[model samples]
Target chain A: MIFRIAWRNIWRNKIRSLVILLSVAIGLFAGIAVLALYKGMMNSRVRTVIYSETGHIQLHHKTFKNDYEARFVISNPEKLLQELRKNESVKQVATRTITQGMLATTTGSAGVQINGIDPAMENKVSGLLQKIRVGSGFEPGKKNQVLIGKKLADKMKLKPSSKLVLTFTDADGNIISAAFRVAAIYQSENTPMDERNVYVQQTELNPILNLGNGIHEIALILKQDTATHTVAKQLQQKYPDLLVEPWQNLSPETELMIDTVDITSYIIIGIILFALAFGIVNTMLMAILERTQEIGVMMALGMNRIRLFLLVFLETIFLTLIGTPIGLGIAWIVTSYYHRNGLNLESMGKEMMSNFGFSTLVYPEFPTEKLLGIMGIVLFTALASCIYPALKALRLRPIEALRK
Target chain B: MSTVIDAHNISKIYNKENIPVYAINNVHLHINQGEFTALVGPSGSGKTTLLNLIGGLDKPDEGKIEINGIDITAMSPNKLIDFRLRNIGFVFQSFNLIPVLTARENVEFIMQLQGINKTEREARIQTLFRQIGLEDKMDSRPSQLSGGQQQRVAVARALASKPQFVLADEPTANLDTASASNLLDIMALLNKEENITFIFSTHDARVIERARRVITLVDGRITSDTAKVDTHVQH
Candidate 1:
């Protein structure tokens, strides 16, 4: 009966109450959707970094992790590949034999980093497979095929099936040159990674750096994120001479950028939550004041102050219960729509990615844990709004309330 | 047969403008069971304040008030509220029925507070409305009814609780002469037939004339206390 009375009393000023409710709902919904979008964008960017550029785990000779320029190529790629393929968690194991080299064409010569991998193995685990914009896929186990970044390819004026010679100092300090055809071209999201490294099938890196069957690093892809750390740990024990780093270590800037976004989104949402709380408090106080006489009559008729407190509290709870889901529903609809079409920041290309320290084309992901936090915030704001009004009602003298 | 209300040296002070005004001052009074009494005074003569104090709607400072064998002035705020719900009913001069509620709902309010079921509460409300000559108007809201009809609804609400006493503050003040007479007659019949006490604070001549005992006050002091032989009920 008290609830019935409170509910009816709330509608007496329909426009005012509705205005407050709508404001809270709008604020809450925007906060919820933005938070979700932030998380989604982070996951998509992180995914591009991990699967396309950085594998789940990378293994380097103990000295090369601290210094990438060190020529500590793993002496037994054949043996290590066999050992890694034995682990069931390993989805694909690819090799990278790299050196700082210069590419010389008839027109000009420029500096670059060279990475060699088996094309068949690279595609199974690397995101580069999905990023091939033109030309054929990486040719398998061949000595003359290479994949050049789109910007690098544009700068060099090389197309698929075009030939370019790579020149660099060998381990013995002798300059060597090798010829290779551009088997594919890739548009990299991040510019630093794009302009420097050109990918080749394992033996194609041979004559340019005077490298042989050995690779400087081994990249392992795992089926899921949980397996990444476990596989790294296992590989570390298996080869004590090599240092294994997870994808997070391979790409710290991406994680840091995502963390920054999460905190910034939180700061914005916190302000919105504060505004929403004030709106609820203002409206509820007005409601309690308007029904002062009715409350007095209810008290005189033997309803306790606790019951009166609940009457007001329940009105807020009911309004929030109805309003929050509507807000969440709106958030869900927007998130689902964006999740479908995807946010394309592709226009600025590598410069945007390098400046932001992320891949430009970001896909949003919605995980359960973060999305459900919105309910706690909405409920807490609603509950918090009722306190001052309920306490004031409990303090009022019955006669004064009736008289007023 | 015995005193049902005892107010001893009851006083109420209002702190307005930091200047204390004594609304009710050291007043002593006793009301017996089945008494039909009227307390008459002009505005701010402490009549409504005294009535509120007796009705457990307000407390008296520096005094003792015993109602129905309970020293109610000593009771806690919550206990006093319960006492009012169980033992006292009120009819205000403004006929402060919830404007949204029908006449029957206004009368049935106290019974609903008592947790009475719909069927029994409805029947009692119907009987009371018929007694007040508002059977057909039971479904009408207070605004839909005339001022006289609205006061009858207030009178019916006061009696719905079936309390030992009804505290009415100028209940007939808003009504015309005929409605005032009619309300007083219905109240008189209830006082006689049910042995319920009716205590009213009013300046209405019609109300004072119908009272079996009149207590008149001036400037917070009683000027007269007299009893009439009998009220002439206009048939």
Candidate 2:
């Protein structure tokens, strides 16, 4: 009956109920937007790393990952390729040889890092072919053809079919030079990556390294959520002096940074929930003040302090139960839409997002648990806010309350 | 029947900053079982204050109050409210009904507070409405009813708990003369029929003329205690 009365009290003043409910809705909306943006930024980074920098995993000589100076060339490239193909765990493996040196043209030349790859294998490993919007994918074994990162191409004022010179430096510090055609211009998600990197055929690089059939690394594409620990163990045991790195290990700093962002978003949610709790407290205080006389009458009519306490507490709960769901629903819709379409944050504010290593485009990624936990906190804080009002109602003396 | 209220040297003082105002000076009063007495005084003669002290709504600055022999002034805040809910009912000058509650529900509120069985509460409220000539007005809100009707609803609410004493703080002040007389007669009739104690703090001559006993006050002091002519009681 007290519950029934509390519910009806809201209807007694429709305008007041609506006003309080609006505050709840706005508070919830702000919290939801913060969460969505945070998750979206994380998702965009994952996409960029997967689609551009590295495949899901990379295979390198044990010392190469540490030194990263081209010391991990595959000793028996064919055997490793055969073994990798036979195992379903390895989705795709593309071999690449990297050497850094200086290059020049009639206009200007700058120092750059050159990567030699089989175009077909490169497409399977890095999805580079899919991102080639303006030109065609790189061709395998082309003697003088190469793909230059868009940033490099822009600096050189070069276009498709433009002539470029690639120079490879061997581990012994021997420099070998070759002329190549610009097969395509590849765009990198990050400007730093885009401004560097020259790609050519593995055959073109084989002679430069002087290892007849040597390759520095094999970029491997694997299914999402695979058992990376087991796969790394197997690959390491099969090929001595070689190591396999999953996405998480390959980008530990990035992962840690993303986790930090997640925690920060939750902290933001806590602050918003506190603000929301205070709003409800203010509303409840006003409600009690308005009904002072009625409260006194109830007290004189033998209503115990506990009953009045329960009345105010129950009223806050009722309002929250009805109002919180509205904002949650809106958040769910907006997040779902962004998750599907993938937000274009780059389009919205490109410079700001890129400053944090984020692309202009973002996708809302809200997990069920994250959504549920945020809602629970909102609800708990709202209920907690009611305690003061309930206590006040209980502490009221019929005499002092009725005096005015 | 037993005495419903025993007030001892009840003094209520008000303070605005350091200045002190005595709302109820040291006074002692008693209301016996099923007695209808009026406490008549000017607006600030401390009549309402004294009534509140007796109703267990306010604590005396220097005295103790007992309702149904229970020392409510000495009781915890929780217990005092419980005693009020079970033992007293109030009708205020403004007909202080819960605006959200319908006429019948407002009357049923005290019983609801008792946590009484729903079937019994419904029956009691039904009977109350039938007596108050508001059987058709049960579901109507306080605003839907006339001033007299609203006060009658307040009257029904006070009586529904079947309390030993029902306190009225000028319950008829807002009603028309005819409505006031009718309300007074209904209250008087209830006093005779149920032997329920009805106490009023009022200046209305109509109520004083019909009250079984009138206790008049001037500037917080009892001036006249009179016995008025009795009117015929209704069945």
Candidate 3:
């Protein structure tokens, strides 16, 4: 009966109750939508880093990563490749002979990381061949053919079929210069990576470095990204001499970004929940004040303070329950629509996002776990907001309240 | 019948922070079971204060109030609330009904708080509603009824728990003459039919004339306590 009374009491002033309900619903919708946008942006950045720069896992000579010298090359590369091919978790593997060098044209020169990759295998791991913007990917038997970023080509005033000179130290510590023709110009979302990286056939650069059949790095993409750590740990235990790391370890900046995004999203949610709490408190207090005489009558009729408190508590919870699903449903529809078609911020933030290594088009993702977590947060917020008003109701003296 | 209420030298002081004004000044009073009593006085005469003290809604500043042989003043606040719920019923001048609840719900509310079962609560509320001539208005909210009808529902609510006594503070103050007379007739009939005790404070002459015992107060002191017999007993 008390519960029924409480339920009916909220509707006594329909406008007031609806105002509170709408505020809660809109607050939740805004918070959730913003969180989804940030989640999408951060997830996109991580995916780009893994698929373009660092594969799910990477292996290098223990000293190769510390200094990108051609001399520090992986040993017995054929044997390791064979072993990795038999592992079920390994989806694809590519080898690269890395050298920090300079690329020069008749007009200009710039510092670059030249990656000598096996075209076919590198395509499977990095999807490099697919991002070709200006020209076709490397021809199978072509010698001294290279892929350069569109940005680097533009900076050096070169294009497909342009001749460029790569200058670097060979394994014997001799200054060596090799000439290569650009087969393709790729454009990725990451501006800096595009400008600083150039790829050539490993067969071509390894011979110039006088490091026959040797490679500096082996990158692997797993069937599932989550298997990267397990595969990395296994590789480490088997080949203790090599450096084996997952994308998270190889790209600590992106890892930190993931953590930072999660923290900031929660902080945003906390702020929104706190703001909604104050609104709820104000509404509940108004309800209590308006029903002061009725509350006194109940108390005088032997309704205890605890029951009075429960009545208010139940009312607030009902309001939250009514509002939360509506908010979530609206957010779900909005996010789903964007997730399918993509939310394109190209006109507004394309350049900014690309500079930070994120794509301009984002697919907002509302994970089931996050949705459940937000529901829990709303309920807790409602319960917390009710405390002050419920206590205020309990503090009323029956005689004085009745007089009022 | 035993003494249902014993207010011994009870004094209630208001405005003790700046001015200590006595609302009920060491007034000792007693009433037996099944008595129809009226506490009447002019404004500021402490009739409501006396009723509040007796109902356990407020505690007296000095001296004790005992109801049905239990010293309610000595009980804890929680115990006093429980005691009031079982022992006394109250009707307010404004007919302070829970506006959201129907007339039947108002009558059922105290029994619900007492954890009464649904069947018994329905049965008791039905009987009381019938007794107050409000069986047809049981489903009506206080706002949907007239002032007199609301007051009758309030009376039925006060009697729903079958308490030892009912305390009404200016219950008919808002009613018209016909409604006030109709309400007093119901109360007098219930007093005769069920031997139920009723102690109400009123300035209405109609209610005062029907009360078997009239206690008038002036300036927080009972100026007169008179009993008249052989008149409206047949009503």
TM-score of each: 0.81, 0.86, 0.94
Q: Which 10 successive residues of model 3 chain B have the least lDDT summed?
A: B226-235
Candidate 1 lDDT over B2-109, as tens digits, reads: 889999898888899999888888788888899999998888888988888888878888698899778999888877766887788788787877765678767776
Give the winner by TM-score: 3
Q: Check candidate 1 and list the clashing pairs.
A: A40-A365, A51-A127, A52-A127
Q: What would the C-alpha RMSD of candidate 2 be, to one decimal place?
A: 4.3
Residue A281 lDDT, candidate 3, scale 0-100 = 95
Q: Per-residue lDDT of B87-204 in model 2, one digit per residue for the tens? A: 8878899898888888988877778778888999989988888878889999998889999999999999988878778999988888899899889988988889888899998888
Q: Write the per-residue lDDT of candidate 2 for residues A1-404, one digit (tens) a residue.
A: 67778999766667777877777776777778778878787777776776567777778877765654655576788988898888887778788887776666667898887888887898777767775644675655555777777777888887888887776667666667788788888876666666677777778676766756778888777665455667777777777678777777877867897899878877887888788778778888888888887887777777766678788887887776667778777778888898888777655676556545577767776545587777777778767988998887776767667654
Model 3: per-residue lDDT, tens digit, A337-402?
A: 999999998998776788889999999887556776777788889889999999999999898899
- Using lDDT, give the best candidate's number: 3
Interface RMSD, model 2, angstroms: 1.4
Best model per DockQ: 3
Q: Model 1 chain A: which ten-residue window has the lowest total lDDT?
A: A359-368
Docking class of 1: acceptable
